[model samples]
Target: MGIDPKTIDWDSLGFNLIETRSMYKATCKKDDSWSPGELIPFGNIELSPAAGVLNYGQGVFEGMKAYRTLKNRIVLFRPEMNAKRISMSTKRLCIPEMDEELFLKAAIEIVKDNVDYIPPYGKGSLYLRPVVWGTGPVLGVKPADEYTFIIFASPVGPYFKGNIKPLHLKVTHNFHRAAPKGIGNAKAIGNYSASLYPSSLAKKTGFDEVIYLNAGNEQLIEEVGSANMFIVKDNVLKTPRLAGSILPGVTRDSVLTLAKEKLDIEVQETDVLLDEVCSADEVFCTGTAVVVTPVGKITSEDGEHSINDGKIGIITHELRSLLLGIQREECEDTLNWLHPID
Candidate 1:
């Protein structure tokens, strides 16, 4: 009965203070070779005042999780996806490329070292964070000459607390998350920083989240601030196409794959029109943090439109269950998406 995982209330669980005493860290020089990766204490390290990340906002990070399955195995859902996305992020900011093999190894080792803190199958998960930052000290307006990669883990509960209900969204027309041919496609720190004000405004107006459509043209739905948007109509799953603006989420890809193979749903990845979304049967958002969120109602310039039953829809619930099954190691992993750590 010592901290029973199943009995632990995920909504009220906070970070436990037990130190893992281990972190995976490595440094890359100008020549692109990585220094020896080491497992060190989870403590702060000093950086130069003129660090490129401090001044130029040259930092990128990825959020992933490890779940203890019903089979008593620790598994990570689609970590390779995180590796690929972080590589793309490096390219976007002119940072040195990371060896995918090395990066993945570091991530896995960090989780393995802290496996005891990984909550039970359904209670919560061990949230994995892989961060890359420009480390060189430079006052000039150019790319940093060096960089550091670090991987850390912490136990986390469900991203959205309370019952898993459909969310309320406000269409943000006055702001844009990313411009065409801009850094919006990358998971950079600056992109999220720029969106804080608009997101705050949306929350103040009684909305659960904000969906930003393309600037000037309200017809094309780009994406939400932190997740990918999806609309269901007539048994079809539609999401915004990658038009050089949206972050391609790993959870979104997993849902599409599961829908096609398990649910037998027609998955469409294309340009979703804002007007068409108003008439969608149901809407949902996907991300690493929030596995899946049902959109209850959408508030736009015209008015609010109620989604399917103003609650979690049938298809949305089905998809969420299927995906969670795979993550929790309850279902047979037909797609081989889960990588077990022990």
Candidate 2:
């Protein structure tokens, strides 16, 4: 069971972990299939001192959220996409791939068991984190003999500290996000670990996040920290193509689709140059956590450039409003994106 709802101050909730009542867990051994997972009390589990995830950093994770919608129902936004992405991530990390059905099942189980922790209809959402780890002990630099999968839930408000104020981003010429043929496209835990240093340095300089450039091409942009980058110019929306370094974000895909089908905007996935972004009409980043955050200002080696006069642009606002409307079931599910849980 979860804590009393009266104990929670939903208005002041931030993007921090507040443990829920239950979680999902399953394990798989090398050369075997995954076990049928079950809902268990939410708590930390012991791991081997020489676990493969500890030594070699063999792990991957997925982020998702369940919303209490205006329709008085609990729902998830495009969870199937998350299932497919996590499957790809597991294969890249050499962990046993979980069946897509099992992945969806575990996600639902954890969220349902912790239903009480879900915030009220307009407050926030229950953020779900599904992680797969190389749990078995390993001596050499190789895949683990066993793997573990877990799903947990927490109620979170906004990803940004001050809410959705347009982000202040800086381009880092000193550090690149990932190599051309590396696991940059995968949701591996190691990939995020590599970003911590650069991102922290940017934050220390009064920026919200760092815009990573493609390691292979210095003039090209890769992503905004962990989110995908997009720039709008002359009424056309352009983002970096799905090269070897950029992670294909679910929110990015949705925005692209909605922009083309709904807004009638021309969408381009090409090599977006740094110079092009600095002069674009609007800039934004998208991800599961950020949803669609407009970029107010972009700072580079040259100087600071204000996007849309340090305000959210028309396209960005429409896309975010459309995205949230669908998530909250306030508008028609035109693309069948929402998955109802109740």
Candidate 3:
């Protein structure tokens, strides 16, 4: 199952699926115990038409990456966090929890089997997606009697095209991504489905993405289409607090930690008003896919407002560099975030 590097145009890789040599698959039986995962050929999976995941949306997934380090070592960044989040999401969705050790093992083994697909050190990294879904057919509105967990890898470049320039965002009051007290906190597949319409509208109107406000107030900023939003003003870093409506992103947490420990910057988590955000010094969003992306302008009903004079801010630049450095093993991982794949 060896992959030929020459077959891939690594430099032109996008955030699209390019299946690797193998993937990890584990199944949870009716007795609530998981089977030992094994590497299987990367391909389609058979499922029942009435599967709980197909009918009732009983699914949860985690996004992570395996990096090729400067010393030619493979590593994962803060995979434990992804495992914890996946467990929490499964609990909320009524699916069986995956063993953290087994989850980690699957991630490592899948990456090992697909090591040849790992993009060269500078081009990009291997994107790992771990998904758990109910496979048992259920006619009623109840949890499934069986489930399956799979981990797969794909080589991807930056999520957003172009250089590390600033991106434009559109704040929409016409749509809400999640409710105040709903499954928004979980990495559920349905949440993204709800966002497709608004996001498509925003993109069609010549904007990068859409910013969703709280469903309750529709004033307080919740998050972007697929990432967590942060605003910098008066030398303090502020982001929307996780009040059960926004997904607590891993990169968002990492940026907050780096701002406090490495840069000694003041960090705050609270409600971010649209009015205040329009006047902020800088704006950015974070996610596993994009990592950190600076916002250049926000288009609202009132008008378009430019952030940091329509350019990337110093804080955003430095933080992105710091995070990327740690990920690529170009800088010291003082927090011991990198878990080497052995």
Highest TM-score against the true fold, candidate: 2
Model 1 worst lDDT run, 10 consecutive residues: 1-10
The digit string of per-residue lDDT tens for model 1 on 1-342 reads 123234445456554533444678898865576655888777777899999999999989888989888998999998999889988988888788777778788988989887777877677888887888999998998888889888877778766556886889999988999998888788898999989999999999888888899764679998876999999999999998887888989999999988899999999999899988889998999987878889999999999999886989888889898998889878899999999887
Q: Score every model by TM-score.
A: 0.94, 0.97, 0.97
**What C-alpha lDDT does candidate 2 achieve relative to the native structure?**
0.91
lDDT scores in order = 0.84, 0.91, 0.90
| Whole-model lDDT, model 1 | 0.84
Residue 206 displacement (Å), model 1: 1.5
Candidate 3 lDDT, 123-182, residue by residue in tens: 788999999999999999999999999998899986665687788999987899999889
lDDT of 2 at 280: 93
Task: Report the alpha-carbon TM-score of model 1 versus the true structure.
Answer: 0.94
lDDT of 2 at 196: 97
In model 2, pairs of residues that clash are none
Q: Clashing residue pairs, candidate 1?
A: none
